[model samples]
Structure formats: C-alpha cells, structure tokens
Target chain A: MNGCMERIYNGLIKENPTFVLMLGMCPTLAVTTSATNGVGMGLSTTVVLVLSNMLISMLRKVIPDSVRMPAFIVVVASFVTIVQFLLQGFVPSLYASLGIYIPLIVVNCIILGRAESYASKNPVLLSIFDGIGMGLGFTVGLTAIGLVREIIGSGKVFGFQLLPLADVAAGKSGYVPVTIFILAPGAFLVLAGLTALQNKVKNNAAKKGKKVREASGCGEGCASCGGCSGKVFPTGNEEE
Target chain B: MVLSENKFMMSSSPHIRSKTTSANIMQIVTAALLPAAAFGVYNFGLPALIMLISTTASAVLTELIYQKLMHKKVTINDFSAVVTGLLLGLNMPSSAPWWMGALGSVFGILVVKQLFGGLGQNIMNPALGARCFLLISFTGQMTTFIYDGVSGPTPLAVLKSGGTVDTMSMLIGKIPGTIGETSVFAIMLGAVILILTGVIDLRIPGTYLATFAVFVGIFGHFQNPDIGFFDPQYITAHLCGGGIMLGAWFMATDYVTSPITKRGQIVYGMLLGILTGLFRLFGGSAEGVSYAIIISNLLVPLIERVTLPKPFGKGGEK
Candidate 1:
C-alpha cells in the first residue's frame, strides 16, 4: 500500500507531468487562458489518462514491441472519442470552449508518456494510480496558470470578478487590467514566472541538504527547447 | 629613482588603469541623455516627469531587492538602472500612468537583466525588451499621444495615412508622440556627446543612418501616397519623425548587446536599417524602430562569431 502511495506521490511531485517532466504543453498553454477552461480540460484529460493506462497495462504482454506505439495510439484515440461525445452531450459549454483542444488531448505527451514509461512496465492497479497522480499534477499546474492569467488579464477568476471593476461589469472605465496575462505572450510569461518560482523552491531545498533534482532549460515550451539537445531530448541526441 | 623602482613593481607588463568605471561610464551616458529627457519633461509636462522618476526608482529598487534576496552585491549605484529607466520612459507616451513605468522598470531589471545573469550577460537590450513588453500588453494606452488641446496621429501615422507632416515641428519636438523621441535635435545633441567620448563609434550609427537614408529615400514615397519617389525633404522628414534617431544612436549601440568587431558592427547596423525599412514600409504599424533594434540585438552573437579575428602571427609562422 505504501509503495502504491509512493507511486502516486512520485507522479504528483517527483515527476509532475507539467513542471517536472514538461509533458503535454500544448493544452497546458492553450486551454489555460481561463480558469474554467483549465479545470474542464484537466478533468477530461484525467478521465482519458486513467482508462488508457489501464487498457495499456492489461495488453502489455499481448502487444509486440515493434507495434507498441501504434497499438497505444489506437487505445488512446478510442478513449478520446468517448470522452469527447460525453463532454459534448453533458457539458456543451466546455466542449465549445475547448474546441479542437478536446480532441488534441489524445496526443498529449503526458498520456502516451505515462503509458509507455509506467503502464507498459507496471501492474494495472499501480498504473492507474500513476495516471491519476499525473493527471492531478497537470490539473494543478493548468489551474494555477489559468487563475493567474484570468485575474490579471481580465480582473476575474473562474468567471467571478474577485477584483470587481467598472470596466469588466459595466461599460464604465475604472481599473485597467494587465491585459498581457490573457494574450498569447501571457501564457509564456506566466509559465516562466511559475517555473522560476519552482526553481527558487528547489534551490532552497538544496540549501537544507535535501536531495532535489536540478531542472535545466527556460521551460519556454518545446519550440524553444526542441533544438537544445543538451536539455530536452538527451537520449535521442546521444544515440545519434 | 622612485620612477625607476616603480617601473619594476612586481606586476605584469602594461600596468595602467584608466579612470573609467562602469559607474562613470553610465554617469556620462546619463549626462549626455539629460538634454533630451529635460526636453521631454518640458514638452510633455508633469506626467512625463512622474513617469520618468517612477521608472528610475522602480528599476533601482528592483535591482537592489533582487540582489538582496539572492545574497549578492546590490548594484543600484552603477546607474545602469537609471539609464534603462530613462530610455524606457522615453520610449513610452507621456500620458502613461505611474504603474506602467513601475512595471516596465521592474520587468526590465528583474526578468531581462537579473534572470539572464545580471548586467553584462543578457542577450538583448533590457530597455528595448521592456518597451516591447509594454507595447504588447497595452496597445491602446501606449499608442495614444495627446498634445495640449489638439489630439493628432504621430508623423508616422500621418505618412501611413497618405498625408504629409511638417518637418520643422518634428525636428523641434512639438509633435504629439513618445516623450523623448519627437526631437531630432535633442537626440542628436546626446549622440554627439556619446560619439565624442568614444563611448559610441561611427561604424554602427553611421552605417545605420546611411543605409536608412538610402532605403527610405527610395521607398518612403509609398508611405505618403501624395509624394513621388526621391523627394529630399520627404526623406529627411522620414528620418526625423520616428524613434529611429533615438534607437540608432542610443539603443542599438548598447555595449553589451551590440557586436564588438568593426565589420560585425557595420553588418549589424545595415541589417537593422534594412529591417526597419521593411517593417516601416510593409508592416502593419507605422513605427518600427524599437522592433528593428530589438531584433538586431538578437543577431549580435552570430555577427561576432563570423567576424572573429584570425590568431595573431599564425599565417607567416606556419
């Protein structure tokens, strides 16, 4: 039981899918423009993640190594369709907001990464816990970023005006929000700021003689770090 | 006898320290900038002064607080913060509120400067980076330039609208625009001071102007639909109107951000000129000076690498 708990904790903190492993940054940057969209996207991804991990773990022995990737995609894509229809039926508003991103979650690196790294190698029950933990970690990261962007960018949080101003509610002019938080650049900036905050915490941990894994790169998404073989794809470069 | 004894003073050869410190150099640059900043305050009135002071104070405070929290030496005394603050303030419209100034200064110092490993190690010019940030964040607020009872578009805007601008008003700084950029005369006065002290060289600024002049002389007629190609006064008006003068002399020639070698500086300068021309003529916005310099600043490393000098006396000896 303790071992199972540790697996959960490991995914949540030790290799948080967003901040630590830096997986599934597409939805992490895109749907995180608003708090409600963040929670909705996160939950939908969580459902897909849990079910897919279980299916992948169950079929690990049956699936051949050469066709593992294709097999995994077929399972993931199947789960995504069900989730999409469910969202479209029950929560039409969220489906509308998420738009293409709801379907894009099938390709979220976090889902496939967990299936490949943990599920394919672990027991079915343990893989389920790993999926739950990683999904929650991604949720935490996305919600935090979304909340910040929403409040600063629009002076609202989760559709409620926490910092109420005349401009947002009425047509009158009053407090001007820092609109950058909601813009495209705001996503990159807020993510950078949060990563910087995370690094500061890690550095503090190191000072107390605690073991903390050093993080490298600016976390400006894969586009910036794609060519930086020293940081991102160390294994691929080494093999080459 | 003392001189002879001191000549053998236990140190390596070539032992003379110049009087120039970072603080002193920054001070000289600040002094050179005072005329333009003063003119901005005079022309734009009290709000410009408030914005200038707020930005300078915020920059110094951000540097001090960051260094303090990080357990490093505070370098606010070096006056680079003040220079960055002044330049960023000048880049902004005089109508900007105190918060924009404060935020811009803090962002420039903290994110652009300290996070990139402090003063000398940043990849881009901090002030220009902050200006771009503010421009992106507050497009509506940043673009509004109101003068007295009359609110009008900037000269660049006028040209973009297929209308002509009076060259004298722009040179004399009577136009409604960013606080420090309207006056060609004041910017030139500061540029002269920088040039004479050898703080800035003619290689970059000269090539920037020459290329810009040639480029604008050919294409600037399209900026004003009424004018035909190659009018001398129209070309001068194009040069005098925007932040090009301020950017070419002050921002592009930043010591840490610009290329080191002579040929590299020339290439860098011409690249800036061409990009400015392309953006000014073809881009959506009327002003392209800040964007052009910031983009050129990113290319300095490549320029330096290509212009690296060959090793000394290697060709003859080998």
Candidate 2:
C-alpha cells in the first residue's frame, strides 16, 4: 500500500510531466491564452489520458513489442476522437476555442509517454493512479499559467470583473484595462516569465534541502544523521 | 638591459588566439554594408540619414542602460549595438519618425536581447524581432515607402494593387520602396563582399535567395501569363521591390538566431523562402520577409536538434 502511494506521489510532484519534466510544452504554450480555455483543455486532456492509460494497461500483455507503439497510438487516437466529438456536441464554445488543438492532443508526448512507460509495465490499478496523478499535475500547471495570463491580459477572471472602476461622471477618474495581454506576443512574454519563476522555485527548494542536510551534520555520506544538529549558518553556506 | 628583460603572460581558454576581434568583424561587416547604405541614402535622402542615426544611437543607449540595470559589465564598445542599430534602420522605411526608431531599438536591445541574457543567448535576431513588433504595432507608418521625393506605394504594394513597374526602373531605384530594397544590384554587390570577407556563411543567404527566386519564378509566371517567358526584368523587379535582399542577407543570417550546422542552415533558409512566398501570394502583405524570418528563427533550435552532426561510432542507435 505504501509502495502504491509512493508511485502516486511521484507522478504528481517529483516527476510532474509539465513543470518538472517539461513535457507537452506545445499545448501548454498554445491553448493557455485564457483561464476558461486552459481549464477546459486541461480537463479534456486529463480525461483522455486516464481512459487511454486504463485501456492500454488492460491490453498490455496481448499486444506484441513490434506493433506496440502503433497500437498505443491507435488507442489514444480513438479516445481523442471520441472526446473531440463529445466536446463539439456539448461544449461548443470550448470546442470552437480549442479547434485545431483538440486534434493536436493526439500527438501530445505526455499521453503516449505515459502509455509506453507506465501503463504497459504496471498493473491496471497502479496505471490508473499514475494517469490520475499525472493528469492532475498537468491540470495544476496549466491552470496556474492560465490564471496569471487571463488576469493580467484581460483584468477579468473566468469572464467576470473583479476590480471596480469609477466611470468619471462629474469630476473623477475611471479604470481602463490594458489590452496588450490578450495578444499573441503577450503569450510568449508570460510563458518566458513563468518559466523563469519555475526555475527560481526549483533553485530555492534545492538550497533549502541543502541547508536542512547541513543542520543535521551529515557532512559526507553518514547514514544515521538526524534532522537537527548544529548552529545554522544561513547566508554564505549556500556556496557549500 | 638584456639580462633584466621580462616576459608578459596572458592565460585564456583559447591558447591560440587570432587577431580577428569582434570589433574588427563588426567594422568589416559595416564596410561591406556601405554600398547598400549609400544607395539607400541616394534614393531616400535626408530622412534615411536621420532614421539611421537615431536608430543606431537608441540601440547603443538601450544596451548601456540594460547593462547598468542588470549589473553586468558594459559591452557597448564592442560595436554590436551599432550593427543592430544599422540593421534596424535598414529594415525600416526612411519616413518612420525618430521616436518609432527609438522604440524599435529599445525593444531590440532591452526586451529581446538583455532580458534573454544578452548577445549570444538571444534566441532571435533582436533587430528583426523589433522590426516585427513595430510592423505589427504601427502598420500604417511601417508600410509607407518613399521614392524620388514622392510619398507613394512601394513596388510590392504596386504589385498587390494590381499595378506593375518597368523592370528597368526597379533595377535603378526609380520605384517607390524602402531605402535598402531599391536596388538588387547594390545589395548583391554588398552580399558578395560580406561572403568574400568571411563575415557570413554562403549557405544561408545563397540557399534563401535561390529558393526565393525559384518560388517567385514559378508562381509569378503562373500569376501573370501575359508576361513573356524568361522576362529578366520582372525577375529583377521582384528581387528588388521589397525586404527580400535585406532580410535574406543580413536578418536571416544573424549568427545567434540562425541554425549552426550546414544542413540545418539549408533547411531553415528553404522553409523561410517558402513561407515568404506563401505570405506574399495568399496573405494580406506585399512582403512577408520579416515575419517569415522571425518564424523560421523560432524553429531554428528544433531544426538544429534534428539535424545534429553525427557522432563517430554512434551510428546504429535510434
């Protein structure tokens, strides 16, 4: 049970396909222009990923090695087609917005990568967990990027105004939203800024881990070291 | 005196250094650019000179400011800023306001180059990126080209408007267009100098120009059946009318933004030519060279990875 839990945790955080591994960057950069579109696309992709993982695991042994990649692609494409049609029939707004990207998800490396790496080798239950964890990680990443872009780009969240504006009726000032954020170049700028932020976060985490290790006095490869040991030198010790 | 003589030592990664400094290379390139620049000034006059000065100054100023802000050692003395400024000026029309040129230089140096970690780290040509930004932002100002003291449509605009110029007029800069794009003869002369001086590789510009010529020849022939076969004039007019020469020789071959490998350079140049042709034929632009080069610049890294030079004894692995 603990081993299964570890696997699930690993997919969600340590081996996150989007932020940590930098997989599926094309869709992440393309469809993340708006929060609504981002969430819609993320959920749709998650559904496809989970279902495809489940199906692939069920047929893993029956499929041969020579034909495995083609078989996996066929399975993923079928699910993608079904999702594409369902979205078109029901959520036509999202369907229209996502347009070519829905078809593009068939080639998204994350889905195929999960199918080949985890689903084919693991049991059905473990594969399902892997799918759910990875899908949710991707969802979190896309939503975070979408939220930043949509808020700054449009000054609105999910198409609702959060900041009040004075309309300057007699002798007052008014609020006006900057419209540069909605353009294509703004997407590139925001993505670059966010990627830099992710790098900073990862670097900070590494520094903190090093500090924790030093406090425990495990200078070399000591096995029995505990959490706390000596006086903490916080600043210059970052070099060590 | 002979017994007391001392030796000077300099240690660096490159133990064997050449006399070819970055400044020397930049100066040589600028020298090679003189023919085209002089032709541009002759055709466009005082406005071209003003725009050139403003663009170059602004680029240098932006680099200095960015270096100060980023707390890095200042490198404005290297003449890269001058190159960027001159390239930006050449890309724009002479009629562009001084402020527009300044804004372009700011966008080029501060936003594109310094913010991306400066110089060699920049993913796209800073000048070309700024040009695209200005083109998208100030379409009215950017597209208006002047000729013979008459503010009129560019030759590409004439083509788009279903009009044509005599091939002889275009070859001599008589047609309305941006300064550097007025004479194909002058541009070819400058390109030859740069190639001979080893300032740029022949692969990119050579492939790009040849592919572009073929595209225009095949498509232009089909578009205008009234024009006779082997119409050298129409071909010359097409080559000189727009941003083709400037973009093909200077902008597309920007060292930092273009592919490194020879094969990658060929693919990159060919794709850029095809896209430029498509944009000119079907899209809402008379010339698509700037946008085509920028798009290809974005794909250079991917092309480089796919066309990586093979490692010895590592052939069989997928």
Candidate 3:
C-alpha cells in the first residue's frame, strides 16, 4: 500500500510530467493559451493514458521487447481515437478548442514513458494508479500555466473576466492585459518561471533534510535507477 | 620601494591600473545620454520626465531588492541599472503611463539582468530587451506618440504608409516619435560625447549605418513608388526618422552582447543593418531597430565563433 501511494506521490510532486520531467512540451506550450483549453487537453490525455497503461500492462508478457515500442504506440493511438470521438460527440466546444492536440496525445512522451517504464513491469492495479497520478500531475501543471497566461494575457479566468479592462478612450484606469502572455513566447516564459519556482521548493525541502531526490534530466525515479531495475517492490515481489 | 608586511600587492600582468571602473564607465555613459534624455523631456514635457524617473528608480530598486533577497553583494552603486533604466525610458513613447516604464525597468533588471547572472552575463542588452518586451506587451500604448496634446503618426510610420515627412523637422527634433528618437540632432550630440570619451569607437556603428544606408538605397523604393533610386532625401530620412541612430550608437555597441573580436564586430554590424532594413522595408512594423539589435545580439556568439583570430605562429607552423 505504501509503495502504491509512493508512486502516486512521485507522479504528482516528485516527478510531475510537465513541471519535472519536462515531457509533452508541444501540447503544454501550444494548447495552454487558456485554462479551459488546458483542462480539456490534460483530461483527454489522462483518459488515453489510463486506458493505454492498463492494456499495455495486461499484454506485457506476450509482447516481445523488440517490437514493444510499436505495440505501445498502437495501444496509445487506439485509445486516443476513442477519446477524440467521445470529446467530439459530447463536448464539441472543448473538442474544437483543443483541435489537433487531442490527436497528438498519441505522441505525448509522458504516457508512453509510464507505459514502458512502470506499467510494463508493475502490477495491473499499480499501473492504473501510476497512469492516474501522472495524468493528474500533467493536468495540474497545464492548468496552472494556462490560468496564469489567461489572467495576465487576457484578464480572464476560465473564460470569465477577472481583471477589469482599462478603457483608455474613456480615460479610466484599470488592468491592461499583457497580450504577449498569450503569444508563443509567453509559454516559454511562464514554463521557465514555474519550473524555477518548483526547483526552489524542492531545493528548500532538501535543505530541511527531507529525502527529496536530486533532479537529474527526468526525475527521482528514472535518475535513481534505470526504471527501478533489479529493485524489490514494496509488495514483497523482487524483480530479477 | 619596500612593501609593508600586510600591504603586499600580488597581482597578475601589468602593475599600472587606470582610474576607470565599471561604475566610472557607466557614469560616462549616463553623462553622454543626458543630452538626448533632456531633449526628450523638453520635447515631450512632464509625462516623459515622470516616465524616465519611474523607470530609473524601479530598475535600481529591483536590482537592490533582488540582490538583498538573494544575499548577493549590492552593485546598484555602479549605475549600470541607471543607464539601463534611462535607455529603456528613452525608448518608451511619451504618452505611455509611467507605470509601464516602471514595469519594463523591473523586467529588464530582475529578469533580463539579475536572473541571467547580472550585468555582463546577460545575453541581450537589458534596455533593448525590456523595450521589446513592453513594445510587444503593450502595442497600443507603446506605439502611440502624442505631441502638443495630439497623437500623430511617426515619420517612419508615414514613410511606411507611402506618405512623406519633412526631413528638416525630423533633423531638428520636431517630429513625432518615441521620446528620445525624434531628435536626430540630440542623439548625434550624445553619440559624439560617447565617441570623444574614448568609451566607443566607430567600428560597429559605422559599418552598421553604412550597410543600412546601402541596403536602403537599393531596396527602399520597392515599397514606396514616390521614392527614387539612390535618393539622398530618402536615405537621410531613413537615417534620421527612427530609432536606428539611437540603437546603432548605443544599444548595438553593448560590450557584453556584441562580439569582442574586431572582425566579429563588423559582421555583427552588417547583420544588424541587413536585419533592420529587411524588417523596416518588408516587415509588418514601421521600425525594426530594437528587434534588429536584439536579434543581432543573439547572433553574436555565432559571429564570434566564425571570426575568431588564429593564435600567433600556431596555424602557420602546424
């Protein structure tokens, strides 16, 4: 149980896909112009991720390692198509706003990364939880970036006006949106800022003698060992 | 001379040291910029002054507070922030609210300067970086040039739109543009001071202006039918009517962002000229000097790599 919980915690904070792993940057930067678009893209990716992780884990024994990458792509792409149609039918607005990104989720490194690293090796129940955790982490990162960009760029939150617009023609003083925040450069600026903020938090936690792992290219899990290779699971099962 | 027990001078290279420091050089730059900044105030009135003061104050304050929070030694006394703030202020439209300048200054100092490891480590000129930031963020506010209580299109804008402007008025500082950019005469005066102080030479600005002039003479008439090929009036107006003079003389010659090698400086200058001319002639905006300078600043590393001088007697012998 503790191991299961650790996987969730690791995904949410210690190894967040967007903020920490720095994966799926294409969708993270492109569709995150607003909070709604961010939520839409993130959740769509989450659904695809969860389903793909479960199926890949179930078929892990039959699938040979040589063709595993192609098999993973096929599983992820099938689930992504279903989510695409479901979104198109039920939530047309979100589907239209999310546009090409929904289809592009097949290529999102986070989903595939978890499938190859954790899902293939871990138990069925644990793989589902890993999918959920990583999905939620990506959702949180996207929503935060989208919320900030929306507020500063458009003076809106979730499509609702948060900051009053300045009417220069009427000589009224109020908020002036920094329109560049909605542009492509704003994505980079906000991502760098939020990533830096989290690094500071992680560093502070480390300074207090907390067992915060050092951040390598990916995160604690990937950096500590090669996908937790030759490690004993908390469930009392040891992988050779 | 006998050295005292505790006063031993152990240093490398030549023992002779000049009185010049970063602070001293920055002070000279500040002094050189005073004429243009002063003309901006006179031309634009109280609002320009307020904008200038707010920017300078905010830049210095941001540096001070950032250093304090990060527990680094305070270097605000060196006046680099002051020069950056003032340069950014001069780049701002006079009609822009004072807070915009303040915000730009904070962005320049905190993000562009201090965040990037402060003064010499910044990849781009801080003032130009901040100016571009503000210009993009607040397009309406940054481009509106108001003079004599009426907003008018800048001469460059007029030229961009197939209309002509008075060259003499532009030269005499009666034109509508950004605070310090309207006055060619005032900017030249500052440039002369910068030159005479031995702080800057003509290598970068000279090649930059020369290339830009040649580019304009060749391609400028394509956008406007009225402009003749190799027209002297068109060339002078191109030179005098925008931020090109201010940018070439001050911003492009930034020590940290520009290439150090003499040959590299020439390549950087020519790149600036071509980019500026390309942007002004074909780009969506009327003026492109700020963009040109910042883009060239980004290319300095590549230029330096290409133009690096061979070591003495190494290449020939090997």
**Which candidate has the highest lDDT of all?**
3
Tens digit per residue, CA lDDT, model 3, B11-85: 677899898889988998899889899999999999999989999999999999999999999999999999999
Q: Cα lDDT of all candidates, in order?
A: 0.84, 0.77, 0.89
Backbone clash pairs for candidate 3 read none
TM-score-best of 1 and 2: 1
lDDT of 2: 0.77
Candidate with top DockQ is 3
lDDT tens digits by residue: candidate 3, A113-225: 98888888776766776888889889999999999999999999999999999998898978999988899989999999999999998899889998665322435444433
Ranking by lDDT: 3, 1, 2
Top of the candidates by TM-score: 3
Model 2 alpha-carbon drift over 4 Å, by segment: A1-13, A47-90, A100-133, A147-193, A208-240, B1-18, B28-58, B61-73, B94-125, B132-152, B160-162, B166-176, B179-219, B248-284, B291-318
Question: What is the overall TM-score of model 2 with all chains considered together?
Answer: 0.63
Overlapping backbone residue pairs in candidate 3 total 0
Question: Could you tell me the lDDT of residue B317 within candidate 2?
Answer: 59
Tell me the docking grade of candidate 3: medium
User: lDDT by residue for model 2 over B102-207, one digit each (tens)?
Assistant: 8889889988888888888887889888888788756777887756656787777777566777776777766667657777777778788888888898899888
Write the residue-wise lDDT of candidate 1 on A1-240 in tens digits. Answer: 233454556666677777878788899888888999889988889999999999998999999999999999999999999999999999999999999999998899999988888788766666776788888888888888899999888889899988856453366756577777898878988888887788788789989998764333333432432332323312211000
TM-scores of the candidates are 0.88, 0.63, 0.93
lDDT value for model 1: 0.84
Who is ahead in DockQ, 1 or 2? 1
User: How is the predicted docking of candidate 1 categorized under the CAPRI scheme?
Assistant: medium
